[model samples]
Target: MVTEYESALEVAERLNRLTPGEFEKRTGLFSTGAEAVENAVKIARTWTGRDAIVVLGHAYHGRTLLTMTMTGKNVPYKEGFGPFAPEVYRVPSPYPYRWAGAATTETGIAEEAFEQLVDQITTQVGTANVAAIIVEPVQGEGGFIVLPEGYMTKVAQFAKENGIVFIADEIQAGLARTGDLFAVDHEGVVPDIVLTAKALAAGMPLSAVTGRAEIMDSVRAGGLGGTYAGNPVACAAAIAALDVIVDEDLPGRARHIEEVVMPRLKELQAECAAIGDVRGRGAMLAMEFVVPGTRTPDPDAAKKVAAHANARGVLTLTAGTYSNVIRLLPPLVISDDLLEDALDVLAEATRTLA
Candidate 1:
């Protein structure tokens, strides 16, 4: 039984300190990732006086109407949820492993694909009416797809040039989950608006939309806020979580997890023929399961591996539009030995399924 009189402002102030010297940002709190995203779009549309938004293929924004329309997958997230919000558009994401014409290496397609994406958006949506372009720096439910190098910078530039807000949906990859306070930090790309949740309040149902002051202030006073939008209890938890992330150097911990997990997953990829790709950054990693000797997605194999891991006391999750990617989102504070043990279980599951 928490009251509204707690400390939402205090938490916002602390979050403000987390990323100093970048953008002069103001923070708004929400009860879930979806709320933050929905509000972000409102703010973007209000600021730009536009009606259209651009999203990428295989993205997972949230399950609400607008966010679901913004999402790319159809099976569980958007199966029967139509008729969706209007004026939302989708474009191709640079998934290195699956880009048709590009080299299928760890570093996937580059400038050519980016230019093509821009062309597609410009041709299809016409940049003048676009309010924002939202993207997940690391596609979470889309199988941990890390944007190719230079992709973020180019997208941000395009958004700025077009007067469209660039909103980075960091719900699943922010708050030190990706070896940085935000995944966009890795590439030195600054977004006009950033939506964060999942790990923000130490598992509490708290999310935030932090952005350039002008963009954030564009919304009318009553246009933002819900009854529990910034509940004080969740804010308190978020404050404590922020302290731990900074004081304990959790971003460094995430990097250490990447160093420990990536190699192991890669070795497993070498041994497991069903593994089509291994990619991600920091602790937000995943392996895409494909048919042996082919690029066909093998969702069945992913299911089997996840089931096996679960039965063995290692809970796992499957992602991707095709449901063939096994994502590893270990906690940032997980002990190395425990993580290694979990990896061992995952390796065994991969081998057994293969």
Candidate 2:
């Protein structure tokens, strides 16, 4: 227990440095990303004295009952799950490829998306009755859907004006994975509660919820914890992983990855009719597969392409709400040669599927 406290303190100090302000920050460690997110909701509800939690379309938080309820997809993740937690509302994301059904300006999408979100919240769940607006700056399971420019800023402003806690679910796009310490950094939007996991402990089964000290303290001391939360071993691993991310400037590396991967995927899109969209940021990128000459999703193409790549020793994963997107989450420390080789395998796989 003494070691756990000490290690957690060290990890908290590291996280505070990355957070935007000098104000006191509170962090609660957990065993997985889902657990940490659930706790964030609990804190938001406790602090705001509300029950409704707002999430964006196609968002994937976790598989736990409450988090699953928060997820936007109905298949696979929530097929048979019954009686999910109530008061969770969803709004359309600024998905440029599918939202407006035509090419549009980023600024226009940002404004329109925000307006729709506000309208939904107002009509579906009153602001005073809402606890939090959870956002995945880059929707992990939603084809690495990066929020439109300025969209996040507007959402954060709305949350602040309406007294709703802005929760940034950075579980997948965080810790330098999106060319930023946090995805919201690109827009200079600081969330009230920031969730971290996946890479935080370098695969050591760790997750964290860091938020404003006051909001976090809203719950009684004994009200926010778990039996295995903040395990000493995981804390130590996180400290080391964080040190490496900073010392090596992993965010910069992610930018390099975006530079290398985006163009190649775009070129492939031009050549392969099934490649409908190439989007995402940093190492978190994806290509949404679609039927030729139309916008219909092509999950079969995505699956075949991923299988082709994996069979040849290059691992790839299929994602998105429709399972028509091949999401690429490469290791931040990957060598240039290895990345190029992986891309070659994917290119071959994509062409083969065609």
What is the lDDT of every predicted structure here?
A: 0.88, 0.91
lDDT of 1 by residue, 255-310 (tens): 99999999999999999899999989999999999999999999999999999999
Candidate 2 Cα deviation (angstroms), residue 336? 0.3
Clashes of 2: 0
Candidate 1 lowest-lDDT run of ten: 101-110
Task: Identify the candidate with maximal lDDT.
Answer: 2
Model 2 TM-score? 0.97
Query: What tens-digit string does per-residue lDDT give for candidate 2 at 213-276?
Result: 9999999868877777888899999999999999999999999999999999998999999998
